[model samples]
Target: MQVDADFRPILGPQLVRLDPMRIKQLQDPLVYSSIDSLAKLSAHCLNLRAPLTTCEKLINSDNTLYLAWKFDEEQNVSRLLGFAKVGRKQLFLYDSQMQTYEGEILCLLDFYVHFSAQRQGVGKQLIDYLLAQEHAEPYQLALDNPSVTLLGFMSQKFGMSKPVWQNTNFVVFDELFQSFAAENGEKAPDGWNRPQTPRRIGAVSTDTRWLRNAVSGHQSKGNAMAAPVDADMTPQGALSNRAHQAKARKAHILSSKPLW
Candidate 1:
C-alpha cells in the first residue's frame, strides 16, 4: 500500500516526522546510533513486547507512519523526546442499526513520550497533529490496547470516555458507526436503525490525589477511585432515586452489549 499523502513529514514546533529518505540515512551507524538506542529505550520504557522498528523497517513499511517529538538541547543537538506509530487497518464496526460491517480506520499502535516528557502536552500535540493531518475526528480513530495513562489522556483531552463495544481488540468511540455511515452514504441494516436517546451516566468525581499517585509511579494506595454516585443521599432520597438508578443501569447494560 502506498503511504497516505497526509503522512508527509510534519515540522511543528514541538514535533517532527523526518523525510523517509532522511530516516533511511540513519542506517549508517556513525550517523544515528544514538537515535536507534533511544528508540529501544522508548519501547522498553513503554513496556512493549516487540522490538521497535528500525530505520530500514520504517522506510520500507508502506502502511505504518512514525512520528517523533523533537527537543533542542544545548549546542543545537536535537533529542528524540517521544514517538508515535499510526497505521491504517481494516476494522469491523457496528452500524446504527447494530449491524456488523467492515470499514477502514486509522489505528494508533504505539504512543510514548519519555517519562520526563509525560504530562507536558507532548502526547496531546502528537495526537492533535495526526487528527488534523488525516482529517479525521478523535472518535473515528481506533486505539490498540491503550494503557491507563493513555486512556486518561484521551478522556481528559478529547472527552472520549465511553467507547463502543467491539469484538475486536481495537477501541473506538460509540458514535463511530453513525458518523462513518453518514460520511459514506451507507444505510444501516433493516431493523437496526431505530432511534435511541443517548443516556447520560451520572457524573462521578475523580480523586485527583489518586490520579497523581498513579502518574508518579507510586504503589497506588488504592484504585483511582470515583466518588460513589449516591454517597451523600439520605435513605428517603435513595428510595426516591431508585427509578433513575434503574434507568442508568439499563442504559449501561445496553451500551455494554457486544455490537457484533
Candidate 2:
C-alpha cells in the first residue's frame, strides 16, 4: 500500500511480508550491507522498556524463529522504521520472575519504530498488517511496561482490553479479540483496518474443531468427527470459556498486585 505524504514518517512506502529465509537474509552481514545499522537499531529497541533480563533472552533466541522488520524505502537502502518478530513458543517468560503461559504463541517479541517514525502510524500499520496474515489466531503479543501504550492503542482500536499476563506485562487477547473485530469492525482511534479473511493457525479449514480433535489422539476418531461438540463443547461454549478465563485473569492481576 502506498504511504501518503501525511503518513510517510509514521509509515514506510510499503509493508513487505518476510518469511524465515528472508529475515535471515537481511540479518546476514554480507547481504544487507548494513548489519551494523540493523544491529544498532535492534539494540536500541532492546534497551527500551524491555528489562535487561528479557532482552538477553531475545538476543539468544533460537535460529529457526522468524523475524520481520518494517522499513521505509528512500533512495538506496531502506531505513529501519520499525520491526516485529513472530515464532511459535510453548511459553514466553517476559519478566524477571519467570512467569510462564501456554498456547502456540505468535509473539510480537520485538516492536520498535525509530525515533523519527513515532506517531505517523508505522507501529499501528505493522501490527494491523501482521494480524491480517493468513495465520492469525491463538497468537499472543507481550509488551513491556512502556510498550503498554501500544497495548492501549490496540485495545481502543480493536474494541478489546489488554490483559496483564503476570502483573509484570500485558498481552493482547489475540484469538478472541481478532474474532470480535472480524465479526464487528475496526474501532482504533486512527481508523486502522483489520485484516480480511481471518484464519486460525494450523487450521486446515473452517472445521478447526474436527482438525484439533484428530490431532489430540482421542481413541474414538469416528465418534469425535460425528459429534463436533460433546455435551461440553460448542462454538458458544468456546466463547464462554474465553470469557471466564479473561475474568479470572483480570481478577488475578488486579487483586494480586499493580502491573506497573
Candidate 3:
C-alpha cells in the first residue's frame, strides 16, 4: 500500500504508513521523540502500562501496518497527533451445528488517539481512511480487546453494536459470519431467520463468565443474584431482575460452551 502521503485533509497534513523499509526514518531523534510523546499520550488515554507499539517493534515486524497522523506546524515543523496499528490475523468461530471451529479472517490489533487530540473526529477519520485503502468494511473486520471508548465510537459511527458470539478473545460482528460463509461457497437456506430489529448500544456483553452465570441464574430464578421477589421488592429491584433475565436470554447461544 502507498505510504508517506496525506490520506485525509481534515485530519492533518500527513498520514504515513510505516513498514520495515520506511520505519528507519523513525530513528531520527526529532521523529522518534515525537512518536514517544504520542505513545505516552495514548497510554494515558487507555490506562495501559505503556505504548502498545514501539519504534523497535515497528522496524522489525512485517505483518503489521502502522499509520501515523501528523500535523505540520510553523517553521516546517511537524507533530505526531495519534496513530493506529492494524494486523491481519485468523479469526475463529464455533459452529454449533457442525461442532467445529472456523478460521481465516482479518482483525484490528491496536487503535489509539492521543488524549489531547480526541473528540475532534480524528479517530473516525483515520479509520475511514484505512478502511477505504484496504477496500474493506468495518463489519468484515474483527477487533482484539477493544476499549470501551472504541466500542462506543464504533456503535455510534458504524452501528457495530451486535457481535456474533465466539469462543475466543477476538470479537467479530455478526456480518462477518455471513460474508465468510458466502466466500466459502456456503449459502443460507431459504427463509432463514434473522434479527428483526436493529442492535442497540450495550445490548451484548463480551464477558463470557458473566453471561454464563446470568443464564444459569435466570433459568433457575428471575435474577442473576437469585434474590427473592416479594411484595417488599421495590420497582428498582423488579427492573434489575428483568434486566438480568434479558441478558441471560440474549446470551443463551453463547453461554452453552466455555471460551477457552
User: Stretches of candidate 1 above 4 Å error?
Assistant: 1-14, 18-22, 25-35, 64-66, 71-76, 94-98, 181-260
RMSD (Å) per prediction? 16.5, 15.9, 14.0
- Local distance difference test, each candidate: 0.57, 0.44, 0.57
Q: For residues 1-260, could you state the per-residue lDDT of candidate 1 as single tens digits?
A: 11112221233454555446656654445324444555676678668775465555567764344465453443344445566777777665543345544446788877777676677887788888878776778887788877677778888999988766566767777666556555545443433332221211233332111100011222222323422223435677667679777887888788996322
Model 3, runs deviating above 4 Å: 1-13, 25-27, 66-68, 72-77, 95-101, 165-167, 182-260
Output the worst ten-in-a-row residue range by lDDT, candidate 3: 207-216
In candidate 1, list every pair of residues with a backbone clash.
Answer: 97-192
Whole-model lDDT for model 2 versus the true structure? 0.44
Per-residue C-alpha lDDT of model 3 across residues 1-260, encoded as one tens digit per residue: 11233324323346666656666754465455556566666777668997777767677775354455554433343445567777665443533232222344556777777665678887788788778766779986677777777778888889888765555666667655545456543432333322211111133312111100011113123334544433325678668879976887768757885322
Better of 2 and 3 by TM-score: 3
After aligning candidate 3 to the native by TM-score, how far in Å is the CA of 8 from where it should be? 15
| TM-score (C-alpha) between model 2 and the true structure | 0.44
Put the candidates in TM-score order, highest first. 3, 1, 2
Per-prediction TM-score, please?
0.57, 0.44, 0.58
- Model 3: which residue pairs collide? none
Positional deviation of residue 175's Cα in model 1 after best superposition, in angstroms: 2.4
Q: Who wins the TM-score comparison?
A: 3
